[model samples]
Target: MDPLYDRLARELRECIVTGVYGAGERLPGVRTLSRTRGVSVATVLAAYRRLEDDVLIEARPRSGYYVRNRPTKAIPAPARSAPAAQPSPVTGQELVLSLVKASNDPAVVQFGAAVPDPSFLPVRTVERALARAARQHRNRAAAYAFPPGLPELRRQIARRMSAYGCATGADDVVITNGCQEALVLALRAVTRPGDVVAIESPTFYGLLQALDSLQLEALEIPTDPVDGLSLEALQLALERWPVRACIATPNFSNPLGYCMSESRKRRLLTLLGARGVPLIEDDIYGDLGFGPRRPPPCLALSEGTGAEVLYCASFSKTLSPGLRVGWLVPGHHQARVEYLKYVLNMASPTVPQLALADVLHSGGYERHLRTVRSDYARAVGRMIEAVTRHFPAGTRITQPAGGFVVWVELAPQVDSLRLAQLARAEGVSIAPGPIFSATQKYRNFMRLSCACPWHSDVETALARLGTLTANLSIG
Candidate 1:
């Protein structure tokens, strides 16, 4: 039997989907809904919350809940990727740099950077926390914090990890500059230069940059657009190549934005455990899930199995990126990672850590997450709708379960690089797919960020991009 809240939510959702409740139409007040439906106010609220999480409705303080204007149609998600089955050198640094530069330009309509817009963030809350930290911990802020960061922050992280089933304590966490640094530490701790690392085909460009920096080769593995990394292909790659370590973003991967199932995560951990290979799991975007609960990390799945899953994550995606706060649990290799972190850079900034700790301790971070998650979910839906309306026939895209980026597979003749160049000239920035691959594949693919609010500017940019892609495809 379904819970009362679930039943209520389902009925309401059906009404909205069927157009019974028109877009922007206000829902009944909590008291009215409870009275009419013979349910408690809590149940009604829960139902409304579920709708908000689903990006179907929004709440306005002092007003009421209103149905969001969602697109009537959406594009079909792209098919599973079939990357080449050989190791390749990473060489997309220049292209990545250009994309980064263009993404940062204030004049451009940014669909390139996988960063949440400030409007969607808790800016005032963060500022208040920073000011309070500076005022209260002036001396601590003045000193350099070594390797393992603030005890309070680590405790907060560990406490949060328990929600995802990771039985970690403060001692297991090592703070770094960001998830990038944490990834570097994990990679350095596990493998040496010239070693081969297995990664998702349409992986994060940052991972490729890390591999390039360390002079490591990447063995591209086939990844599903919806299911995440393909275990069978990875197994084949493991059998064929002398892979040192496996790196993946199991929960809400960049570009692809697929979250591995719990069972698959367990299988992946077991596979790596049997091979004596460490799996570096990046969960930077794990908190941005639009579901009722956060997904479990691979480390959580590997718990008690003795699997060496180095869990890397950060508050950058959820909290404040400018703070550059990230942490990792390196399992058996904790000491080695700590030393590497010390050698790489004595420690992360003290003020930001303390400030973030205060924010987490205040119990406001969770509330902020709820708000941001809803915003991101809505933004992603809007982006999908825009693409469906604008893109030419045969264009395919990824309907991500979470995260703020969408991957689009254009016609074979369409060159995303040329499209990006054209988009930039028109004051728009986009991330070309070639940057996400080590072998420069995905030439007709592109990643679009849904981090910003929907507006005319974004709509215009997508239309322009569609036109450019159509022209390229025709030529």
Candidate 2:
């Protein structure tokens, strides 16, 4: 109905499949085709059109179209049976831990490690507060804080969280050394080793490290580049596996920088809640969003009777990673999680806890976060601009709403591991894609850290990487 080429293309497509021309055979000349088929030369052209459209044949200049060796569609018989897929028995912990240790080497620019530049942290503000708090409560510093965290600090957290619509109280908070310990304690309280847990396909490596240490099994769900894990795939996993809990990052996720949509968030929570599955949410980067305010936490979404979400976060990403001050809002699992925290670490260090409390209560911490957020936004933008100028064609970079990590997909020819080694040899370290994936699927992907100031040298390094990729092309 549209044109002769369209109809001819369809006819040629079927003719190719029906074996009018055998494999490795050249098709008849266009004029001969017109005479044999008794159709216009245009109709013959249209038939060959369909063949090329379906990739069944190729045309050569100075030569006619030739039949390709591609196999035609055939019925696929069912297999007799296949073994069920279980988690891989091998442990990736040592490999990852070694990489983590090596990434911090001074010779490396340390893009692999996600820590912010030390120069950017609010050291002076923290020090002043520590001095004032130490003099005021020197005796209390020696005494142990309560197991549920210091009341004043908890109140500050609750007030801040309440601004985002999360209804929490100091009575429901459990403080731990860092988000790592909080996550581990929550996992310990809710699940045991060998318990199946749903995780995003390319999730935070630290969480993988945690699951390895705890001996939990992971079922990776396919996730989007901008949003998080697919709800349909997750529902399928829930129907298939006995998933005890789910671990996700609804805010700017590490390595991916995806923010799950509010609609998807509600659907995810309700779907998982219905299955009686608990959610272990990591919100460490929530406060670092490039926008005015971070998205709401899953703990805030909890309602009466089915509060299965366990929210965990730390000030490390914002104020200081060394402080190691983090908390858990364990909806419905508060008491059990607190007991686990006590048995695990006794309590977080008293000096840092009170110092954090003093700084937060006095209103210096939020100001520091605002400053850091502004700096980080610039850093992320500069990195993205550098990537667009330097990366290969067909390359797409993640434009995170917040956080300083950018995920890059290189052309398939460039192996990230190889690129990583090359970058390392050149005095820069990068996070390879395999570590983020349980199946190591993203062989050509890499992550760059934008926490450092964007310097000419960094841009030059990216250009060098692009050159390296282009040189390695087989073409």
Candidate 3:
């Protein structure tokens, strides 16, 4: 399909979704639209067909296309999440453990964990790369890859990061077990026990676990469903508290999935830079954006501004999660993170680094991203549509631009934890909202994974989950 048609289709979709064309309203004739938009008849037809495939519009034998009645049109977006206004010690989540256990059971529909299905990853490509690396680095395969990891792997990471607009070198990159360790290292490098770290409300539960282990305090800020972290609330928090670091997933964050705009990123840097607080960027989901260009990290937008941005990312989402190769660009805290990486685990495994570097250098990684990005985008849409149609009329959900998870806000009367237990009894698993917070603020919301391939089993599971949710709302 021509890129032009895709752009036109997107514009037409915005129109239908925004109610420019009301339910069942007819759209302009193909030729008329083609002339008005200054495009060929083929382009118009292609655009209309795209919307048709998305169920946004439909065609009649003799009439022009018409907008389909949208189930989500009347439902407002999820209310912005508001965690505690004060910083407090992080706490463990038992529901997270239960969700993880259910996620591993094949009999259960897997919507608990926010990980992509293995089928959507570059399994074969990485396996081949691993074989080649083992054959080539037979001696080094048994060795420990000391701090900062292999120069070759670091260099590959540095080069890939350059495209994201960060000025990095092999010395600036530090490899860890995965993004989990990267976050722990970044937190330890900049913060101490009882120090405050401002974060998004309804954040990734893994982050809460990291803070809990480090004995750090969390200052949760209200986050918008569309624009991401609210700078106003963060600035206020910084003024009131002695925040040591601010951790954020500015690009396609988990659960919420809002990608902060470039302007917001710049302003955030200036705000934190003024206060001398480091911004620990968890960009694990940065590469999974549905847009044409990969979303740049906060470090990229902070260049020349003299802001402190510690960027962390991993190949686990795009490649094999078990491979466990993640790198961090610690702008000024590079030395601290390196030392901690050595102390925490001595060193990351040698062969996986070499294997990942091989896959990246071969140009297969980017090709793999192109396929998986589309798959995630399509899956997310299907999940949102399903929730919108079958769930309660007032149920709200995030419309993520990227990533494969959707955060749902159910009716206030419903207890999400109870809903999860009910769903589990029917062989369906879901991550209830309370698990996402250290303070456990969102009792009625839940985050659902859309990374699974859409099938009858998955469809049936979501519908059944919706029925259960409705049952709870009634009682």
Most TM-score-accurate candidate: 1
For residues 1-475, what per-residue lDDT tens digits would candidate 2 score against the true structure? 2356655555665566568877778988899978876779888877776565334677889999898764243212111111123343224434466556755676566667788877568888888777877888899888887688788888888888888888788887888888988888878878888888788767777888788788888778777767677788889888988888888988988877778777778888898888999989999999888776678877777674363888899998888888899999887778888788787767887788888888888888887776677667657766765666666666767777788898877777778877777777787777887777655656677788888644556667778877776665543
**For residues 1-475, what per-residue lDDT tens digits would candidate 3 score against the true structure?**
2279877987887686568889999999999998999999999999888777665678988988988766646456787877779998877576677777776788989998976788788778888989988998899998889988999999999999898788888899999899989999999998888899999998999999999988899999999989999999999999899999999999889889999999999999999988889999999999999988988888988865567988888988889888899988887788888889888899999989999999889888888887678768867887888898889878999989888899999999999989988999999889988888878888899999988866678878988999999999999
Once fitted onto the true fold, the runs of candidate 2 whose alpha carbons sit more than 4 angstroms away are 1-91, 102-106, 304-307, 472-475
TM-score per candidate, chains pooled: 0.88, 0.78, 0.87
Give the distance in Å from residue 431's predicted Cα in candidate 1 to where it truly belongs. 0.2
lDDT accuracy of residue 128 in candidate 1: 96
Give the per-residue Cα lDDT of candidate 3 at 287. Answer: 90
RMSD in Å for candidate 3, one decimal?
5.4
Q: If both were scored by TM-score, which would come out higher, candidate 1 or candidate 3? A: 1
**Stretch of 10 with least lDDT, candidate 1:** 69-78
- The alpha-carbon deviation from the true structure for residue 107 of candidate 1, after best TM-score superposition, in angstroms, is 0.7
